[model samples]
Target: MSSSQLPVRAAGNLRSDAGRNRAEIVSAARAVFTEAGTDVPTSRIARRAGVAVATLYRRFPTREALVEAAFADQHADCSRFFSVVEQHPEPWPALRTALRRFCAEQARDKGFTAHLLAACLQGRAPAGAAATSALEAERLTALVRRARDSGAMRPDVGLTELHLLVAGNAGVVAASPPDQAAAASRRFVELFLRSLEVPRRSGAGDGVR
Candidate 1:
């Protein structure tokens, strides 16, 4: 190959290697965070990625940057989920589905649950994460309002109650064994949904109370 072409090929190979290293690092970060929480050491993550610490640092300069990159897809998925839920024609059913999915996610990934809950409740997450949580919260509040207005949800139900339900489900999942966590979360979702639903009357004279 000509000298000029050699330099171009070498640059292309470098770019390819860099991209592969970045992907591996992000993948390793996700696995480590899921297993041991996000506070696990960067050196461990680098080892898991099969890369040097300096390589990981070059790709992600800060712990927060690494965490954010690791969960970028998760945040995107969450936003998409809420957007889809918002479009469902039936407010109550959509909200129920949303709760089930949310609780299931909490059961599946401890690190993700920590990040999302911290972002939503404490506003201590990276900027993108915080923004995603805030948007989802607003979507949920709108869904609750719609459900209540349509007499599908209890009149007293609101965003606070929903947040409490999520927190309670998170607690249940955290306490249960790994094999039982999904079941526990599902049960919690069912109970919370039942409590939030408006009572049905058997006859015209029957009162909801």
Candidate 2:
């Protein structure tokens, strides 16, 4: 019938446009939600996207749905986090860079879905709760193992320890002064690494030292 529909059907450009528009909506929603909270107003998101509230509803039927999508999107961004392991092919530097980004993201995004951020004040924002944690931990353990086997890491640093450290520092990132927070990750990582390094003592007794 209409030329638009015909060409879209033929070239499939219509689907591409729809996908791009949906992504834009999600991106906008994520931006507002991260800065705001889980209870962010629907109209706020729509206004930010320069779209109608109906468009926002069409893309995300519910607040929980939008929150889940935003959480997933945040996790997806993790893969692209810079890893020196991928470049210099070592583990500690990669861990340093990755953990630094993790700290930054925790400070930046602590919506009602960011688990393990010590967001107890927010009371643990579990988007998909157990399911998401299970899926995410699987991926994290794999990365940890890879780094450990590469010999740039200590054998004791497992996923649980990693999670604890991230959780511990996330709050510091949030409450500390801006300039101090900016360097918190590097400083924390350095101290943690130093603690993890091989213990060398000029003279020490196992029970007394």
Winning candidate number (lDDT): 1
Query: What's model 1's lDDT at 2?
Result: 79
Best by TM-score: 1
TM-score of 2: 0.59
Q: TM-scores, in order shown?
A: 0.81, 0.59
User: Judged by lDDT against the true structure, how good is candidate 2?
Assistant: 0.62
Q: In candidate 1, list every pair of residues with a backbone clash.
A: none
Tell me the tens digit of each residue's lDDT in model 1 across 40-90.
889999999999999999999888789888989998898888889889899
lDDT of candidate model 1 versus the reference: 0.82
Separate clash counts for every candidate? 0, 0
Provide the lDDT at 131 for model 1: 66
